[model samples]
Target: MADEVGTYEATVTVTDDEGRTDTDTLYVHVEARDLPEALLSGPGTAIAGESRIYTLFGNAGDALLSSALWTLNGEYQESEDLGGQSSVSLKEKITFEKPGEYRLNGTLADEAGFQAQDSMNITVWSPTAHLLVTLTDTNSPVNESEVLEVDATVENLGQAKSDQPVWLTREGNVVDVIPGMELRPGETADVTLEWQTDPGDAGTHDIGVHSLNDTDSGEAVVTPGGGGDVFFAVGYTSPPPSTVAPGETVQPTVEVTNTGTATGTQTVVMLDIHGTPVESTEMTLSPGESRKVTTFSWTPTVSDLGTGDLVVQSEDDEASAEVTVQGSTHFDVEFASVVPTNTSKITPPGPHDWINVTVNVTNTGDTPGKQDIRLTRTVWPPKPTLPREQKDEVQNVTLDPGESTEVELLWWSPRTSDLQSCDGETKCYLIYTQLGIHSEDDEEYKMPYDRGGGGGGGNPPCTGPNPPPDSWCGTPVTLFSASEIEAGDSVGVSVKIYNHYASTEWRGVNIKSHHVSSYGPGSYKNWQAKLEADDSAQPGQKIKVCVTMESWAGSHLRSNYDPKAKAPAARKGSFGCSTIPVVDGGDDGGGGGGR
Candidate 1:
């Protein structure tokens, strides 16, 4: 039984009848009992339009193999299925027109009535395909329910052409669609879409354009208050503390722009979930004017752990924004030591001195945390408001449950003015170090400290009061901060105005005119501080004034404002201005551009 499937010899003796007298030897042949084995051989992988060889390894055990069969995917194959010789070898050459997986099989049967079969898989690969989508110039503020025009560009970067359809969606809903139209390799095309939102579509909406394999998206929002030639568009909304902790209050604001020729009043409202009103603010805007209105601050409780809408409305127009209310765990951090080293200084205490402060922080809280360290130098006494301040911060400092780390922050010196003099021979600058603990999960926890005074330990010599005997003491005008904005946009400027009258206190003092670059000192429309109203300063006192500037000209600008000075001699002070670079953009025709 062990020696199977082969020819065997058998012997027989004719002495059975006589038992011993006559003995005859006879030989007999034994047939093989094993079946023929069929083995199929072919490449496991191939490219479309390429030819591959498939062979059948066949054998019959001690017997002739009379029939050999070939099949593919359960279908029978002819003798010359691949234009090859029909023999026991059964070799075939095949080319697949399409890319996919296929099975090749072969079966062999011997004359002894036994058969065997074998199979193998072959894979075909097609060319590569890549699709890309792009959105351009989506930075302009869009109003709700208004017609928005956008261009979606599609490009094929792969070797194959695409016949898929491209779909454009807004807020997850398909708004526009286009056929691929067979884009060749490295080909690109643009599809323009004109989309108009429903009147009730007043919130932020994301628009996306996508193909089967790629996608791109941009965001837009609509504003409220529009009817009969007057339209108020909500331009922007910023939700502060995008993520908030439980029982925490956050201030959020909504900005609206008037794109009409006349002035109008609009009402903006904010609401939490459950149809409860939060805050409402009324704003009057002139033609081409845009104003930001702040609603009542919102406090989110533990039950408000999800997302809610903060809606703003004006007349028939409406806009809505999403505010996320989240909960978090508490953590704490401590400041161990704060050491400051002066690396460089200007003789007159200019604004560019390099002062490095090294701070040692420890995670004293129960849970591990990351700390935020900030160093600030501000002037005291709001009367002589040196609006200027120098600040630096280390954003994130990591620590273990009981670990400690040291970090460094840099600050520059504050600018000095002639009207403001140091109380002593040295000028006084108040230093403060603040430690904040914030996590991905919760709001920030803060600890504050007044680190005492700086400016060479005592006080750096600062410009002091000079009595008016000769041409009113020269008042030093300093530009504190100015917002660098894009061309065709508006910015707020903070300037320190000093009182220079020796014997007289100026009343009804206001910023009369201002200039940006060589553009204007035009009439004032909207300002943060109204000096002519209830605000005033003494002879040695300085006040901070915030002036908003707008220009359509695309260039860097410097701000200079002239204060209403009673005495002609006090007006001789030269005003220092800071340069703000305006980004490039054509006029949007919002009508707020400087004339």
Candidate 2:
């Protein structure tokens, strides 16, 4: 970096392992080097979880670069500390976890601390999972009730593992997203998605799954009747109501587009979940033409309460959107998926085990309401006279219209007596959760094969205990923690911690955010980690928080372990978390995502 330019004499010598020596003529050329400048090259459009290599060449890869710093801004903020003075190359691969517009900036600094900066604006897409979708059914001219299976081989080609949902698409539309695919780097998984054919359609139907990235080119012919040169794709133009009173009129507009190469006239009909036609309208459209038709005022009665779908069918294609109908009562509860928190087993649930179950419920009524949702457990296909049903839990649910909430319940695994009435040959014994006049979801558990031997952590809780067993004695793990930490003007942060295990006593807990506020700078022993974000943090910038728990003379803490896997289960009378967390219990141990 010096201004002085000079060439000095240089010498070169070589020596063999033996006592032998050789010399060659050497020349030296020296000149004043230019200041380092940041040069960055990468794709402007990137897939969210797909890693792409980017290069930062300082002065066209000739400068004596001391360091190269990479920073992401705009939709999100990220700083990559890359490239030291002795770095062999400036090429680095980066994977954006979320879809957003980000300015990727690169800075190169010289030994004198002189630096230059360059950047590129990149837009990330959310289709991070690459899937090769193909049909598993070989039946031709299939029957209406015949099930068509879609095999989507989804692969996580990225460098990181994620629990992001893997959505199944049909005709370039998302029909379902299988949650918890949980793929690791270079991992491949086979997800079987079902596409049930419409009930009374005898026509050549074109059905296919979406590959998300527009790479899935496979399609399967569902039924064969008419060789239609003219086809129509149908969908809804206007959305349905969040909640509709009983006997009230609902008219959602349906749109049909001509995707075939010929001009065609087709009747678009509104149907129910059972493919029962409720109303119909006919229209003619040229190729690539779209026309809208409203459903003739369909009214729902009290019997048609709870939730249903607004299904529209035109020709061989159909699309549907969820529609909810509220009864005379002000509240209607819709049950969603159930996630197990603080649990050791998910598949083939063990008996007599203590586990926390998180139930997602949404209020789809017009007005705010509070009511209790009861979860019951009985042998599947319960016979009233036999009467072996067990009333498990009754948790109060309160929410405004269209609002969803999670309720955590402690499920004591069913003992041998619980499964006595059900026949093992039928194999329908399972857990059930329901509310009055609303639908419910179920979870199944199995009786441990070897109960006396007490294997696989399936044995019942210890009745007589002193210094209990290993995991029972003290297997300390994070039960819950904040999802995010938010700090701003007048920022008052509060974090809560609750222990699920009675024996595993937490000596201390702490929450630390990115910026120093009223709280201390770093993590300290405290019950809560009430921290704030930096004042300079802009939109999409993440405020990171650290939640930790110290166990006094116990097993080492497990961080961010999935409840679906073998780890720890919650004890009775213990609720909430961040007594040790990384799990989002019913109550979030900390704040959530970037705010």
Candidate 1 is scored at a TM of: 0.19
Please list the C-alpha lDDT of all candidates, in the order they appear: 0.50, 0.49
Candidate 1 local lDDT, 310-394, one digit each (tens) = 5555543556666677543333434443333332421223444454545556655434455555555443221144442334554
Cα RMSDs of all predictions?
29.9, 32.1
lDDT, residue 394, model 2:
73
lDDT of 2 by residue, 48-129 (tens): 7678888876652344456667777833333444444533247767787655567887777756566787889888765444
Off-target runs (Cα >4 Å) in candidate 2 are 1-4, 7-95, 98-105, 108-152, 156-187, 190-316, 319-595
How do all models score by TM-score? 0.19, 0.22
Clashes of each: 15, 14
Candidate 1 regions off by >4 Å? Answer: 1-32, 80-87, 129-178, 181-595
| Worst lDDT 10-window in candidate 2 | 567-576
